[model samples]
Target: MPTDAHPAAPRPAVDHDVLIVGGGHNGLTAAAYLARTGKRVLLLERDDHLGGAAVSAEAFEGVDARLSRYSYLVSLLPQRIVDDLGLDVRLVRRRFSSYTPDPRDPSRGLLVDGEADAASARDAFARVGAEGDAEAWQAFYAETARVAERLFPTLTEPLPTRAEARSLIADEHAWDAFVERPLGETIDARFADDLVRGVVATDGLIGTFTDLDDPSLDANRCFLYHVIGGGTGDWDVPVGGMGAVSGELARVAREAGAVLRTDAEVVAIDGDSGEVRWREGGVDRTARAHVVLAGVAPVVLDRLVAAAAGTASGATEPSAGAAASVAPRDEPAAGAHSDEVPLDAGARHRLARAGMPEGAQVKVNLLLTRLPRLADASVAPEQAFAGTFHINELETQLDAAYRRAAAGDLPDPLPCEIYCHTLSDRTILGTGLAESEAQTLTVFGLHVPDRLVDAHGNDELRERLRDAVLASLDSVLAEPIADVIAMDAAGRPCIEVKTTRDLEHALNMPGGNIFHGTLSWPWLEPGAEAATPADRWGVATAHPRVLMCGSGAVRGGAVSGIGGHNAAMAVLEEELP
Candidate 1:
């Protein structure tokens, strides 16, 4: 197999065919693919551990639970990446799709069982006075399934034009509902029940903070990504937690002869000369490469390149809750950053438009003594919490919450969802914990924008938001959720709440925007350019030698490796010596 000579030898200066910044899952993926082609690949990560957000950690002190700390669940990960790398990753499909308790009556709710018969689901819908929605729900997802079948395959291929993608989807009605019009209008037209409509709309608002009726239709983009995963949109639990996914990728990359280094922070990159400078353990170093794959947000890339050209300002660290506004799509005027290092005009425009990304959700992890009882008597607690358990997310409630949050006030009865990881996979629990029937709960709160964190300090807002979220969950439960929380060894409550500000400090994610930045349309606009191979693959930067291999890439989002895969494909298209 092709390998970097003397893999363990330390070199002050070395030249590699490909140098990747950030050892997140995407970086690892790019390294494995490039190294398998006999190219010398070097990956550097700022954190001591490899995985970025996709990792499992023993969060509670003296608690034996290994929770998927940041990013939970697996949906968009392609089977192709697994087969290509021969990764030993197992994902467990939850039998239930989601259970949303009715806000008007906690005892009545809708439970969607994936393994149940059509009549069973219809009965559940009937209980919530949404019997008419059962047929509409199936039809809506059926259309998405068709779109998924067509659109998912193009993710790994070269960029498809707007016209090309529309043609591929074939169904004009489906395209109009998801691609052309605002999602709110379509949901309003199709579904009659508020709770049922909210169930569908929740997918649109996951990490994005946007009004459903916004003409820009950014929510449509987010919704499309949620429903098109793995051509089925079935979010499965990763066996042994999210860390297993990254661990397998790291292993495959290492075994394929890629050099991986942790705690190495890349400070600058000279795009013209392909020189990268990084600091590790208080020691500064440099390396040259034929190509550089930036596995970071676009805004961060601009800062690095600016620093290399000596045109950057004194402020190197990104501020918390950076610009929460949606980036304008129009090409911005010049005179922002300098024009050195072949920074493309459009790339600069994108940077200027990209204010700090604003992540919208608040994540709270809890290790519970046992599953809390649901108010809905017909459905057992195990069945309701197994999948996504949504609370206070009715269509009207979601809109009202957005209004309140946009007005700089915290939404009362915060809309959120809960996922019981232990229900599907018991291995995440320690031997003692598992034997005692302990469970782990991952709560994701919607409409909790970074702006709130900016208005209220992280410490203050964390507690307030945590209280609000638990209260919302409590609204649907038989007893208070706080009573069931397991205590850590030190007598502290085993609850971990991460606000966007917290994410920014912990993960170097500017604005804590989970997708790196607002997600872009998978296909280029009608008149957009795609002249180069990198451009065609949607991984291009201003510099020809540099490409994006992170969530910031056109088709990149969630746990999917499309960005890295396409970046490798783009590099492989060129003849490399």
Candidate 2:
């Protein structure tokens, strides 16, 4: 709990070339790039640790299993950032793509083995009565692959106009399917099987609470990000878990001469003057910089900016409680703003539109004594659990789940996916645990929005949701999942559940929305404004000095460093002060 300044005597205000708030992976990326250019950079993190939602920890008591506690898997991170920063992290591609067991008949399942030939995949699809979908699947992904190759390279560059991006894609049919029309229409037209269609549609719903046919096209944006990672749809597992990814970024930033401080909670930011106020070790400190990079949600940034303005004008101090409260989907949090700070028209409009994002997911981490046996005896447990294991997530089932959850009720037979990190890399476990064949399962339950948690208290709903998720998992398993769960040294079950409320309290993400808010289209619409370099990069805020460098930025979702990279590029475009 070290402080940036002494408690007895506050330090004089300091100045830097660039000041970054929130020391997440994106913030660390900005610090590394900016500091390497010989610009003085300072990064402050509220928590004791650096990584935001991208850290690995031993969840079970004395388990010695370093599980990725929150965000697992890497799909959107660019190799250019890794090569530029000289990150020493390694990512392993899963041999099996995915395996989804038929909920109607547990004996039949669809297994997508990456190593298997096309004929093998066709046969696997045939087993689940989706033989025709095999060719459709290939065709759909092939189209996405083409889009990825053309669009991914532009993520780290300046923003492209809608027409410019469409022209670059060079395929009107692909554009009409993925970009123009509703994603649901494309899935319906291309795939005949319900399960196959669901597999394709799940990408559109990850961490995003939206229907495929929504006019906003948020689901389409989510799907695009899922498939365009590193110019491919492959989501690789980090060797030492997600911590390795952040650890490398931290090392690079520090080596590049960026000053990163933990346990330093930034309370206010003056966008007009580039001044930042923070609390550390019970002391208040002030710092000013030429540019400010915010690695936070837009809603949170609005509060900070307002707080700063209020302090300057001798208004009442704003409460930080909103950062920890659970908000309904597409609704503003109670006590989110203060009337003491009058907002301009632009700020008011931004807040009204942004509201508080609601994350529709429940993450569960479990340590198993052994992998569960699948009802479909043809597929081995290792193969089934190697990649994403879909459970009760057919197209019809997913729609029903969404409808139920939207009505303030829990979905029956919740749809979820499981990933076994240990199968791809054993480095996360201790030698004894690895030798004992212990495995870790990361379960991500979909369609369970924060609204449900708000209705049912987090504590009561956590247990209920855990039971429901396990029940859904048991449907596809040969034996009860509880039978295989390992016990920790404290004689407790080696399972941990994290709800949206838990995320809000732990990560400061409003409503536990992982992407900070809704995903934005990568390109700007026709007649849109891009007057500044930051705007051109799609990282601009209302103020010229402040820029977004996190998941809130356009093209800035998932574990990708594109947001940070693009923000830095925008700053570098300006002449050095």
Name the runs in model 1 displaced over 4 angstroms.
Answer: 1-14, 314-354
Instruction: Report the number of clashing residue pairs per model.
Output: 0, 0
Candidate 2 residues 279-358, lDDT tens each? 99999999998899999877677778867776322122222112221222333334546788666654543443344578
Q: Each candidate: what lDDT?
A: 0.86, 0.86
Candidate 2 segments exceeding 4 Å error? 1-14, 311-354
Worst window of 10 by summed lDDT in candidate 2: 313-322
lDDT of 1 by residue, 372-392 (tens): 888898889999998899999
lDDT computed for candidate 2: 0.86
**TM-score of every model?**
0.91, 0.91
At residue 373, candidate 1 shows an lDDT of 86
- Model 1: lDDT equals 0.86
